[model samples]
Target: MFKGFLTLRPSCEVCGLDYSFADPADGPAFFVICFACIPSVALAVWLEVAFEAPYWVHAFTTLPFMLLTCIPPLRPLKGWLVASQYFYKAEEGKLVRLETPRNDDLHPHSA
Candidate 1:
């Protein structure tokens, strides 16, 4: 499911930190909302259903649950996003560097 959502792979633009897509062993990053976060989210939903909490309670409870789910996993997700913007090109037994446009440049129109 996440594979479809992530249109770009993670890599370091400056350091050429690209992962091998062909390798079957390279599972999705923990922070990318794979199997681990699902159970907690499901549990949160169950709590909401079982307790019949008011809307505000459900909304407040969800914030912490989402933080728990998201915070730890962010490291790898950020690394991957950074890496995806760069790649290594070999030339004459040396490596040449290339970079994608910076995030700021991509969103210049935004306030």
Candidate 2:
């Protein structure tokens, strides 16, 4: 359900399914940050602590590694989440209030 690297198509080409409900906003990015960026950051920290690597080292190694690990999987992750939502028919929760009987309603006196 994607048209570009991170852009979604309006509808599915084969099934013609509307993608309006597929709002995986920040989910993919959050996963990437948690799974990929954290490790890359740890690598950077290790490099700094062990070898005292300079900024250029991070710019060359850590940055590219982080980008490669973080960027590539976002689209597929988003698609998987969207498909899961569709399969499960997930939607926003609605607040439903039930009426409770008052004490006066419980006791009705015949006049």
Candidate 3:
């Protein structure tokens, strides 16, 4: 399903499913930044505040941890999101006309 690490193929090879609808965009990145990166940031902050850690400590510890948390899960998360979009048939909303009774239909006896 993937053409590259973060890119998708144009369509599915086996099922011939078009990938045009799989526009996950920054959803995977946003999730990684919001959910995954927080703990790494917290750890860095705590180290700085509590232990007064040096830059090299962060380089060895926090940097690797952040990369591990943030980068690796992106492809899986994006695939899951795209699969969900396909399964749920997610699409843009459209304005639809509702059928309501006109005056003639509501007051047929009055006529």
Candidate 4:
């Protein structure tokens, strides 16, 4: 069984503005950011067929092209890629929260 998790911030904490849910049906912008790898994966498969390359070679070669394609479009997709990882875990335990403060909040003198 595959279970997916999405941590959605559906409102502005400061302004209390309501945002849409992150679910695919909600038509939120989250999926645009989160699914950048889908194109890359598809391209890899297409390249494999188009080039008639071995699976490993196609996989490696397409990676650089994918990176190139992804970089230009990253402004819209970056948030989604970052947030999508929260849905998967390496082990069978609940996700652990790290208490690290944001870089902006850390004082230069404290470091």
Candidate 5:
């Protein structure tokens, strides 16, 4: 339904809410990167231990598995994060009240 790095669509299907609030802004990629680190480190360690292979073998061994682990979940992770944003009404923070006093208020004796 959605497309592009930013949103391609302009509105919602079910709630009729505007799609602007759904801006996840790298959230999915961030999540994928955070997740990828764990397994990649583990894979590197495991390959070193299990195979007792040399450095060249480590490159060959880890490369394919890195691709296998990193590439597949990207789209789905992005979709889930976007969907979560939409359903939960996630958005930038708002200015509820500006409490700074006016010049007159600050210098009431002068006034």
Candidate 6:
């Protein structure tokens, strides 16, 4: 826990095992921002426009609500994403090569 954020090679708290394979990268952060920020902002805008709320009301309510929505869920979302990655053995996509060529390519003019 002390060095979890500082190092990529953090260990499991319960099992005390190495977590070398847990490389979710920025995926969790990206998800949190996309899902949480979008909806919060959208709702905030809607509420402001619909109710004609004042600037102070928007400032006090919307910002804190946005923070609440994003901050609390971030850790769990990141954990879930990382855990899902590990559970599924997810990896980066690699370039594939064709092992054989089509017969039409070789016999283009034979017909």
Better of 1 and 6 by TM-score: 6
lDDT of 6 by residue, 1-111 (tens): 224432444777777766676776777678878988998899789988899899898899899989888877766666777678778988778999977978988899998
For candidate 4, the clash count comes to: 2
Q: Which stretches of candidate 1 lie above 4 Å from their native place?
A: 1-31, 77-111
Considering only N, C-alpha and C atoms within 3 Å, which residue pairs clash in candidate 5?
none
TM-scores vs. true structure, each candidate: 0.38, 0.86, 0.83, 0.30, 0.62, 0.72
Consecutive 10-residue window with the lowest summed lDDT within model 1:
83-92
Candidate 5 per-residue lDDT, tens place, 4-103, comes to 6444467667767676666667776677678885788788998788878798886787877777777777777766876888688788888898789899
Model 3 stretches with alpha carbons more than 4 Å out: 95-111
Better of 1 and 5 by TM-score: 5
**Rank list by lDDT:** 3, 2, 6, 5, 1, 4
Better of 2 and 4 by TM-score: 2
Which stretches of model 5 miss by more than 4 angstroms? 2-18, 49-51, 98-111
> Residues 28-96, candidate 4, lDDT per residue (tens digit)?
344443555577777777777788778688657777866666555544343344334334422334878
User: Each prediction's Cα lDDT score?
Assistant: 0.55, 0.91, 0.95, 0.53, 0.74, 0.76
Question: Is 2 or 3 the stronger prediction by lDDT?
Answer: 3
RMSD of each predicted structure: 16.1, 2.8, 2.8, 15.8, 4.5, 3.6
lDDT of 2: 0.91
TM-score: model 1 vs. ground truth: 0.38
Off by over 4 Å in 6: 1-9, 100-111
Model 3 lDDT per residue over 1-111, tens place: 998899999999999999998889999999999998999999999999999999999999999999999999999999999999999998877999999999999989998
lDDT of each residue in 21-99, candidate 2, tens digit only = 7888889999999999999999999999999999999999999999999999899999998998899888877999999
Model 2, position 55: C-alpha lDDT score: 97
Candidate 3 accuracy as lDDT: 0.95
1-111: candidate 1 lDDT, tens digit per residue:
123344334443566555443222233454346755676678678877899777787678776777677666655564454444323331224667888899898999885
